[model samples]
Target: MLLISAAPAAAQDTGLNGMSRDQWLPTTVASDAPLPDDATLDTDDCRYDAELPSAFDADALRTSETAAVITVERPGPGGEGMDTCGTVAADGVDLPERLSLGSYVLYDVDSGEVLAAKDPYGLYRPASVIKILLVMIALDDLDMDELVPVTAEMANVDGSKVGVGPDGKYTARQLLQGLVMNSGNDAALALAGALGGTDTTVDRMQELANSLGAVATTVTTVNGLDTPDVQTTAYDLAQIYRAAFQREDVRTLLSTETATFPGYGEYPEFQIASDNGMLYDYPGALGGKTGFTDNARHTFAAAAQRDGRTLGVVMLNSTIAAGRLWSQAESVLDAGFDATSDTSVGTLTGGSTGEDAGPDAASAASAAPTESSLSSSTTPLVIAGLGVVTVLLAGAWRLSRRRS
Candidate 1:
């Protein structure tokens, strides 16, 4: 018989000194280190035999069969953190800046390098910005050509609407027009109900966002109507914006300044004009979503391309007196493209617009939000709590008599 010695189970308790055996020494019995406080650890932070999920799995809840997964690291110190956001915006003062308030981000489509960002991870009500995720979920699950009959609930949508009255059936394409061009809340509800044959599309939105590493965000309504749970961080919104913008349909809808969707009776073929001001003034300005609620304030996302370069911009809960988000996005986009004109970091070499460098260049930026600089009304209280932690830590260190 072969001699066998049974291994001990892992320790779960912390010692008197406030360190577990696993904590006092790195748990070498397992190959992986404990997950940081920021992450949701599986297997008790041990390297289990099974594979563990990543901190953020952008590809997990994809709605499309062919959707590819992309992951961008969170912003932090020594990590790809918020400092990156501040530096990029600060670099481009010479350009005609447009953003008035809130967080913003821009990145290279090929290099995955953030060209410019401001307050990327600041949390704010996304308003209709949440529609980006809803639209993606619909695209992922249903075909673009599929028709969804407008329901009474969809028709009764409160905020910005495309005016699809009860039982006025629309093809998925038409609904998408309402969603992208008009930022129609009614279109959002219709899309959500159509996605799963029910009104719970907000849950699907949350699942997709969670998969994309937007840990602090949640969605309670398809239209971003005022609800306690309907909120997202700047980083989360950027990620969703990036995902939606990847589709060809989304791109077309965004760039259009005026659209003539077939209208209802006696409406005389109503014509819709885009609310985004940058589309008219800014070069290569692809339009995006705009939103506002009592809780969310002003929010917007815009994508622009020039000389084979593309950038996405988002702003949330900006100073109300500062003006609209489209103008802000234009300013940020100008700064980003302007920066490319300079030779500071990795600059794009000569490449004509006709030649495609393949899909790699187009998918370059991360969806992660920048570090939050804006303080909430409750932030001061949180700071006071931290001060208490510092005092406690100091006292504990003195009691232990450990002096470095």
Candidate 2:
């Protein structure tokens, strides 16, 4: 369990620890340590029986169909008593009750604290959330205003699209807006081509992931289309998004609710609206990404600020409900904001041994909201099955339309 330090006398007396305004923040966890018994660090479905030979095997990941099932060592242990991964201390913030999610992490951007988490290191499909990485790499290498010619290959992508035609010409900025605001796979392909081909773009994304110490992440597709080998952990997702959030352009593009794409050549003018629901509903929502695939399920990454503190949340393999992701993210952020000054949870560790352990490992242990309490509830399972079915049916409908 995370440790909660009692507020100062004035705060205790007034029942208001003005943590929102105070500049003196607690020290972030700096080393690997065992987490409290209640922390949700492991799950039967996501753990590996033995440590991996390497943090990541890019060659194996690219060639193997069963590679997604292989789990790598994460910073923290699975739960209270497990010692496979070291433990860390954390304030016992109650997770939302009965929230059905596969893996999640909640992180404080400013304090570098993991407020709460569940299977934070577990690998799951990132879906469109992977586009965050694509956008990051693009911003680093490509000019935002440079016009990219939409090729036939880009226009033919199967998932969410912004309708850029084969002959369409769009600026990198417009394509980015489409990629993020509209969750456009076509935009992703276009951007990838602009940075070279899909192969080169994915290579750069993998390099970026490795450099960030996101060793568990493997990129098989630039747009996060459900590929057999593509996978990423919630911890990695948080890290990727945090890095992207630091850039003014990426932040602006993500927070944008609407954009107008002027028709170029053969492409017709069209207006696109953001698919991320949190921007409209959650106050202080900076930006977020949402994704789904037949295999990836529902994935969401979002951040919000309150009382001068900003928090980021990542949910992977979540259930499909109209607003569940937003509500869950809001709940986590609310709990983080409500935490007292003395709330010290276990630190997220860098898995590197000896001297190789750098700030990345210590600061990278991601967090996510867990069930405040566990109970034998059959309803969530049923709902999850239904959600999968809905997704499959939606995919079938899309396939049918394409065939027609």
The whole-model lDDT of each prediction reads 0.52, 0.59
lDDT of 2: 0.59
Per-residue lDDT of 181-206 in model 1, one digit per residue for the tens?
A: 67777777777777764356767777
For model 1, the stretches where C-alpha displacement exceeds 4 angstroms are 1-99, 197-199, 265-268, 340-404
Compose the digit string of candidate 2's lDDT tens values, residues 1-404. 00011122243221122222111111112124321221122354444223211111122223344564546553443333222222222466655553545577777765545767666666677878888878766655566568897888778778678778877778877788788877888889999888889998888778766655575788888888765467787767766666665444456667766556667665578555566667656788888888865345567898887877778888876543223466667877777767765464533332222111223333322211012111112112232354555445435543542242
Mark the 10 consecutive residues where model 1 has the least summed lDDT.
48-57
TM-score of 1: 0.61
lDDT measured at residue 395 in model 2 versus the true structure, 0 to 100: 51
